[model samples]
Target: MDELEAIKVTFFQECEELLADLEGGLLAMQDGNDDGDTVNAVFRAVHSIKGGAGAFGLEPLVRFAHVFETLLDAVRSNEVPATPDLVVTLLRASDVLADHVSSARGLGDVDEAVSASMAAELKACTDPNAAPAPAAAPVEAAAPVVEASVAVPAAEALIGADDALDDDDLGFDFQPMTITIDEQAADVAAAAGNVWTVSIRPKSDLYRKANETALLLRELARLGPIEATLDASAIPPLELLDAEAAYATWTVRLETDEDENAIREVFEFVDGDCDLEITRGEAVATDDALAALLAGSAPAPAPT
Candidate 1:
């Protein structure tokens, strides 16, 4: 077998491990283990599969995983309450996901009618308003390779989406970074057709989840042209750096007329993993006092 084919083998090997984690986490929830971390682990399992499938151009796996991931996200966010019925549905979805993996491996064909039925059910759990569909789009029986494995690294290799954390010396102090937005320019930028400044500060959990910053930025670029500035000030020297630590932040100037919600969807998957702030116009310092006041976490300023 060629080197590229070998990488595909590695990905499938990783998928088996990930699928095991998915099943374990879902079962934990089903057994009344509604811990936030448990739900996150379950979400990461599906998300990692989706990322790997996308790299391999396995459309069927990616599509089904996306729908499954969405529902898991809702459960994680508490948007969809974890009811007994919901847990059963999640278990069923997990089974279908395993079949997709097996199908991708050229083991056997997946039952299309059942897969489509599960997709609709998963989507409905996330969005009750979604239109019912008889079936999903036609998917290929044998997973095809769109690009050489070397050209696109599998998500499993980049970083684990959900690994148990251990205390290791970071070798440097970690401080959170904030983006400053200029108030006046922001006001003008809030107008139609003006630019939007978005700040993203990812935590260690984001990288732990195997999310790629480049992918998020690429999604943002779809809205309009974007100028991104990386904040590497918090990054320690190589000798002092922690391999597991996420240190860089970004400030992006997007020339788009899209609403804030549109910009938000780009980073939805990493919602709890990062600190995000979106503003219109130029740059200025973020006022901690004002922010606290706005959030209703602190009292208002006294009138002079």
Candidate 2:
């Protein structure tokens, strides 16, 4: 196959894996394991699919995935509860999403009515008070109404007479800001001279997306002196290896007074795409102890 065709094939293959993860995570939540990581996994799956679809100009697939993702984001941010009804709706939406992927691959056509119906259901989960669009309502017609209703209030708030408005007038309470600084805390941190251990294990998708490990390491090095070790224990024999799969992980010992957040900022863009942890402590006396600490802690499974 040509390069474009090959890339398209790879994207669909990744979609299959992501869909499996999405389904598995949803099932776990259904079984009462609704943790933050599980919610993040589901969000990442849809997000990756949407990103790939957009690259290929799969407009319909992207559009539906975008709506599906918005609802998932609400659940992630705790704006909406992961109630039984919402989970059921999300699973049904996932099925439709799979159909959308198939249609994008030219396997078959998705009925407009079915897609529209599912989209409306997903939208309802985002706004509990909002009703699903009538089945007879045209998709284009219903979409504009929803968009306008949401946009108008925001526009009015910005342009409305500010003198006439109070904190309560906006339908939500507003609190004044406060800021304080503790010089003693800063002095203690500086005096402690603590070091941090940063562990990172990136999934294959990170490389596939052209994220450079070298760049991440360089960024970390900027924060302080870093001794990095690459672990290739997971690599298979050459003949058994898949070129696209990631098998290596990294363990880095950083001698920096930077806070944990500073270390995490190096990996913020890839927050959900990899496994990362930062812990602060006194510097280790030997490399072996650091290695043992790194090896003893099992890395979270990389994104599927």
* Highest-scoring model, TM-score: 1
lDDT of 1 by residue, 20-128 (tens): 9988988889899989999999999899898887677576676688789878888999999999999999999999999999999999989988988998888889778
What is the lDDT for 187 in model 2?
38
**What TM-score, computed on C-alpha atoms, does each candidate reach?**
0.50, 0.45
TM-score of 2: 0.45
lDDT of 2 by residue, 185-249 (tens): 43353367666767789898666644556656766776765667788999999999999998888
Candidate 1 has a TM-score of 0.50
Clashes of each: 6, 0
Worst 10 residues of 1 by lDDT: 147-156
Which residue runs of candidate 2 sit more than 4 Å off their true CA positions? 129-131, 134-304
